[model samples]
Target: MKFLHLISIIISSIFLLNPAFGQTDQWPKRTIKFVVGFGPGGANDIVARIVAEGVSKQLGQPVIVENKPGAGSVLGADFVAKSPSDGYTFFVSAGGIITNPMIKKSMPYKEGDLVPVALLAVSPSIIVVPPDSTIKNLRDLIARAKDAKGIQFSTAGTGSTPHFVAEMLKVNAGGKYDIIPYKSGSEAKVAVLSNQVDATSESSAVTIPQIQGGKLRAIASTWNKRIEALPNVPTTKEEGYPQILIGHWAGLFAPKGTPNEILDKMNKAVEAALKSSEVQKRLVPQGIEPTPGSRASFVNFLNDERNRLAPIVQRANMRDD
Candidate 1:
């Protein structure tokens, strides 16, 4: 009888110790941290906050956004890449994740250090000028750039998607337009708004408000399709410069080795958040389009992005250092 009892006890202990017993249980018991690579008010921050609200409700726990902005968003991305693989920590980053490695002499973390969780949004860049400037259309802008001695353009920063798009214009349009880099997209927008710079291609999120207020004019968009906020603006494709079709995108990622189950849960939560009406209502006007997708899909998207930009980076000889 003792032998039988011992056998039964062992079986019970084994069952209790089995990972499957508690695998799906008590997850997300504490607050989850969502790290943003950009400072407040940027497209990455805005998208993370909006999604955090929805994710918080979906997960029944608070989702906080911690901004560690700098190094063109590399600071925040590296933080998450080195963080514990527990599901509690996630990252919200922009296109810099792919672009940085292409240009920067070195990076603290490899691009593969983070696993793609979800793609949050795609924000097209807009080529804008101060309202009173004479540059009215994409063709005219290119012509003036080639004709003038010092046609200047500004972008959020070097290696940023906007910056690359500006470079694309210079290389593809075969113009001598000089690019002026700023610390942030807001600062770059200010340069164009104050006429400190002749033009700038900035995230539509940063330009839409001013465009609507008549402070700036939208001459062209980087998106293949016209953005709703700037309905009248032509696309780079429409302007005969399809090579400049680059824009900003936001996505979530977890540290490498993070359990696939955790990644899936976060992915589902983000999808739910993205589909929520609140997110749509808030982000669309800011020129952000929510792109909630699965882990595999996000990975494939990243791969495609790399392939698309590889030629641009190589041909332009763009480098961060």
Candidate 2:
């Protein structure tokens, strides 16, 4: 009896001290769900699906991409923020999540509601004009905006990153511009294509097709460097408005209370997915560069981005209420 009691205590100690014990080890015993805050077939959804497939294979479990698009992605974000912290659910969204609270009057969740898991990819925003538009370049557009009513520009939404890019350009280039808000990036592109707006800013991946098809002329990229997909187009830096550098990114996040162990596993899974040949091949050509990193790095990146854009949002008095 004494020997049996000693063995039981020894087994309990091992289980308590070692993570190889049981609970976290059997973690993804079921399907993992990636909650995308955008509709299907869009940039966010497509990337989520690609990464999800690779992650599923890497973890030897089924990872599903579920779209919960609504309210400029706030709905999906809120859903994930309130989800169980069991590591089964994740929120994959654009950098807008960090900026939304600053720009909106009422947000469903605070910044601390979610924790960063991994940095998926970064895509720079491109300012484009229709093929026939007289606005030849960024300088020309600024010159036009310096006039009485200013130049008209359309974007995905009022408080979206594309809108912020336009606002940043207006502030740095010393001019005013009329902003027209559309429901989606596609609509903004259409506004420019139909000459309804003088210009529009969209993700490089989304605008590349139009630029390549000669439907739109690439003016400038809202990034520090020229986009490889559109090598001829200059960046905001080259255009002399380096302060306007802005790039949209997608990343994974979980509810704030999630376990660190699970977060680490998810980050590893995502990094492995990003490194796979399949993910790289699909992302690189579309101007979405994979940027996997540790949880600390991702958190720091988010903090830096939020700080950088807070001033812009405040200066413009931009609110999505």
Candidate 3:
């Protein structure tokens, strides 16, 4: 009886000292959810679905995507930030996650509430107009914006990547346009397609198909290099607007205090999913680039991205409203 009691105490101690030995190891026994702060058909939704499918396969669990669109993705971010840190709920965050706090007067959840898990992918914003519109290029659009009536530019929201692009044009190129906010990039794209708005800067992942289908005309890719899917489209730098460079990047994040073991596992799963041929094939043509990196690297990347955009947001006087 004494020996048996000693063995029981040792086992209990091991589990207590390494709680992950039990909890983290058995994690995700049920369905896991990837929350997207945007509507369907947008870049965030598209990437989340693709990665969720792959992650489900890798983890042997049903990984699902749920959209909670509003307040520039704050709704979804807050939901995830407040969710249980049980390795079951993760956030598929865009650039807005970093810029929202910079622009918004108040955030429902603190930035530290969510911790980075992995950087998944990125897509440069593409300045596009309706196919039938007379705006030939970036310069033409800028020239048109100089008119007294100006032009209408649609965006997902005030702090979204498209909004930043629009602000960049106004500050750097002397372009003046009225920003029209929509629920999601998909809605903004529709506004441009139906001629409700003159143009929009949307993620290439969301705009490449429309451009290829002749529904929209690509004016410039908002990056240093030309998009692989739209090689003919000039970059903003080539169009003489070097300051207008930004892209929408998606990263996985979990509620703070999540076990490091679970975070590491999720990051590995994401990296594996990104390397799969199916994911690459689907993402590449959409102008999305897979970015697989460690959790620490993702944290560093986030810091760098925030630093880079802070000045732009300040100069543009961006606000959530």
TM of each candidate vs. truth: 0.91, 0.91, 0.88
User: Which pairs, if any, clash in model 1?
Assistant: none
Best by lDDT: 3
Give the residue spans of candidate 1 off by over 4 A.
1-24
Local distance difference test values of all predictions, in order = 0.86, 0.86, 0.90
lDDT of 3 by residue, 1-321 (tens): 999999999999987775456788777789999999988887788889999998988999999999998888899999999998778899999988999899989999999999999999889899999999989999899999998878899988778888888888998888578999897778898999999999999889878877998999999999778888998999999988888888888999999878998999999999999999989999988999888889999999999888889998888788765
lDDT of 3: 0.90
**On a 0 to 1 TM-score scale, where does candidate 1 land against the true structure?**
0.91
Candidate 3: pairs in clash: none
Error of 2 at 184 (Å): 1.7
Model 2 segments beyond 4 Å from truth? Answer: 1-22
As a TM-score, model 2 comes out at 0.91
Report the candidate with higher lDDT, 1 versus 3.
3
lDDT of model number 1: 0.86
RMSD of candidates 1 onward, in order: 3.4, 3.5, 3.0
